[model samples]
Target: MTLDALKIPETPVCAAALEVAVAYCSPALLNHSVRAYIWAAAYGEAQGIAFDPELLYVGSMFHDIALMPEFDNHTAGFDVASGHVAWVFGAGAGWPVTRRRRLVEVVISHMLDSVDVAADPEGHLLERSTSMDISGRHMDDFSAPFKAEVLRRYPRLGIAEEFLACFRDQAVRKPDSSPAASLRDNIAERILANQLDRTG
Candidate 1:
């Protein structure tokens, strides 16, 4: 299925966020960001979850932005820094303070091991979807047909190597951060072994 087949949000905010991602993210990273949203929305539909598409779409776009050199932070974790960036983006998009904070929460929460879907459906979906895209975690949650179409439309483009390099660098610089913890937990192996890497 195409992205349009998934009914992706086409609001001004969604369009603007895509622009920002395209401007800053490498081609591989840009496709990964878009795939992140596609995965989340597809999973949400299959599960019958009611989530704010705009929040999830924008959060997915900015969730890994700190992986870029210009956005990387010296002290805070990449997820934390990315959260702040999304907050700023939300403000510029004319979102209220509460909504902006929710955006920040969704972006940062994607790094967590798990998020309560009832409390924050967008965060829950994003976390699960990023994990699905990166390490094939919870791959069974999506049907084989859906997974095939998503991969066909937005190929991984060797994100296995690209993302591992990003995380390895992050681990070196932010020894006390989440990426460091992930490396310690053998995330590199997981990324390399991801089932998606073997597909189209």
Candidate 2:
């Protein structure tokens, strides 16, 4: 769905969260993160899934915060590390413990292959959107026109290459990390072809 049609939540806390996320992540990551939000919102609408706008927005913005130095937990996997970052950010924003718990799931589960949406729609939406953007795994659900409009509004600027590099470097630096264990195939294929895997 286009941004013009998507009802973006612009709560003060959401804006603040995104601003903090931008400050911590790379330009490519920032761009991809924002697109992840857009895609999540769009996918929710298409699937008739009800989601909290602010929750989805904040979760998507900081979903990969673990990759940044301030949020990185040297021993923790990227998923849990980023969840910790999101929890801290949410707490500072006056988010209640319940919401923070949900946000943690939303941010961390985005890396999972599939999620039980019945339990957490917000997390499921972010998971689908993250896959859609990072690997174009769900591009078929988003029509060509919609995809073009999104790209027009949010030019990739080599996000695929940059994000893959980040994932690769993370794997190298932390061999026991989640990315190394679960995403090695993606990095190897994308690196060899210089392309995001078109396959799901």
Candidate 3:
């Protein structure tokens, strides 16, 4: 969906904040933001979650803006930058302090696998869920807590079964790769599959 189609608060402050975020991000990365925002918004909607598309869009666009060349790692960059984007965007939008803080927390906490997996198993599960969601698969081995948390956070996104199935198919398709690469390939395949299906 286009930014105009989103139901964000259309204040000047919000617009400026979005501009700042887009300015800080690279064009290619910004493209990723578009796709990510679409996925996130759709997932949230499907699960009956109430998310600000503008927040998801701007937040995700600049989530990795803080990345330094030394830390070319996607996970690490996302972890650090998500926090910064939340802060900057929240402040720029003049959001209520409490709401801003919550937004920051959400952004900082969004990148699940990028953080400590042992300490934040929930985050890991979220990462896995997102992967499965993107791949349009179902994951049979997902823990109850993980499933519950996902459903809780995204009540509008009721595609858990489909996501799990896609997740399992992706794993079977690429059994030997690292989880990150596997997730990437899963997303790529899903995109290709969508295109083929649409055209066919």
Q: Quantify all predictions' global Cα lDDT against the true fold.
A: 0.91, 0.80, 0.46
Candidate 2 clashing pairs?
A: none
Question: Using TM-score as the measure, which candidate wins?
Answer: 1
- What is the C-alpha lDDT profile of model 2 across 1-200, one tens digit per residue? 55698877979988898889778988778888888899888988988998899999999888888887777777787788889888988899999999999999899889888888888898998988887777666667677777777777777777777767667767877898868865656544534342233222
Candidate 1's residue-wise lDDT over 1-200, tens digit each? 44567887889999999999999998889989999999899889889999999999999999999999999999888899999999999999999999999999999999899999999999999999999899889979776777888888888888889999989888898899999999999988889999988765
In candidate 1, where is summed lDDT lowest over 10 consecutive residues? Answer: 1-10
What TM-score would every model get versus the actual structure?
0.96, 0.90, 0.48
Q: Runs in model 3 with CA error above 4 Å?
A: 1-9, 68-78, 113-200
Best by lDDT: 1
Better candidate by TM-score, 2 or 3 = 2
lDDT of 3 by residue, 102-139 (tens): 55554555444353435433233334334444443433
